[model samples]
Target: MEHKALWTLKFFNFDPSKTQNKRRRQMLELEEMWLHAYDSSRSYKEQLKSKWSGPFIVKSVRPHGAIELVDPAANDQQSSWVVNGQRLKHYLGGEVERLSTVMKLVDP
Candidate 1:
């Protein structure tokens, strides 16, 4: 029993040092942002729909990997929210334009 318990603990343990090796946030303040949609909101047939939405502006970066974003399409400050860095991606306008062009060619 003791041997089994020791082996399980050793196997399940994570190296604390490894957690520090994660890549730094790619998004920055004042940059355009996109938040990923919830998986439950998507359907299998409409899988081609974009997984991200918004060209929201990055309002501020918070400690512990949270970011504040503002939706340019909305007039009220209530439209803003703080989200974790993992849920966001930097919005690239040129890439979006290129993708739309490609999609038009493929679909029409």
Candidate 2:
């Protein structure tokens, strides 16, 4: 029991004050866009998967730099999930441009 306690103490010896601040200053902005990291384990074929998914909108910012995402299609809270800032990447319309090009090819 003493060994276990000492191990636990050593494992949690991190200083809360020394934790690095979030590099993302835009997280606090309302309706900011983000791409959520995808769970690649769910894919049956390893090569047919993307690293991140969705251009989800930021619904709200939590106290510790966590963010609540908004469902763009549904516009409801039912399908939303909270994720840490590090797990997200800014969605800069590259996907949208690709989608538009695909749509043009199909329609034309």
Candidate 3:
């Protein structure tokens, strides 16, 4: 059987008025969720290791407020994020890992 590579993207939007402390906590939790998702997906892990050279990266696209993730092998696979035309974040692969919905937490 041949294994085909797949990509994912996830989006999460937060209220602009949330407190900084609340936002910080939310981001930390979101990172955990992202890690869980990454670990559960075998293809994602292998691709990240086989393709990326350094640690995984996340880039923020402002205004629209989107974050792009890069692992390794980004350049080879065109996996990094671009703003206007400039490439942002470290190269993880020629192709980027599929993104997923951003995890949001309600203020507590």
Candidate 4:
């Protein structure tokens, strides 16, 4: 009886293939993002280093979630490289707020 009940539950359960993954891509629009370091072979001295690198500018967004990145500090566009969107996270610069203040040009 116990084995029969387990079999029935599996048939009624939801299918994983039908489920949609909403978090499939990181950022859709072109913006700054950080690339996860894929270097598994690391030195013993550099064990404490952060795995994520770059606040790289998003040069373009390709089909099938492919993203091209370029170094903002670099003068030429030759330093650009392509990476997957999953391996990247947005670089939202400490979430700083922008506020503008107007000043009088001359005294009345």
Query: Candidate 4's error at 3, in angstroms?
Result: 44
| Tens-digit lDDT string for candidate 4 (79-103) | 7778889978767777534479999
What's the candidate order when arranged by decreasing TM-score? 4, 1, 2, 3
- Rank all candidate structures by their lDDT, best first, as comma-separated numbers: 4, 1, 2, 3
Worst 10 residues of 1 by lDDT: 23-32
Candidate 2 displacement at residue 27 in angstroms: 48
Candidate closer to the true structure by TM-score (higher is better), 1 or 2:
1
lDDT of 1 by residue, 10-98 (tens): 87896655554432234432132432333334564365243235687778999999998887677695677787888787776655433
Report backbone clashes per prediction. Answer: 0, 0, 30, 0
How far in Å is the alpha carbon of 25 misplaced in model 3?
Answer: 0.5
List the candidate 1 regions with Cα displacement exceeding 4 Å. Answer: 1-52, 95-108
> Given candidate 2, what's the lDDT at residue 106?
58
Stretches off by above 4 angstroms in model 3 are: 1-18, 43-108
Tens-digit lDDT track of model 2 for 1-108: 999999899779965554433334445332243222234444544543332345777878998989988767665556767878787877776655332333445555
The sequence of per-residue lDDT tens digits that candidate 3 reaches over residues 2-101 is 2222222211344455668798999999999999887889777787566445655555455554555554545554466533324334555577667789
Q: Between 2 and 3, whose TM-score is larger?
A: 2
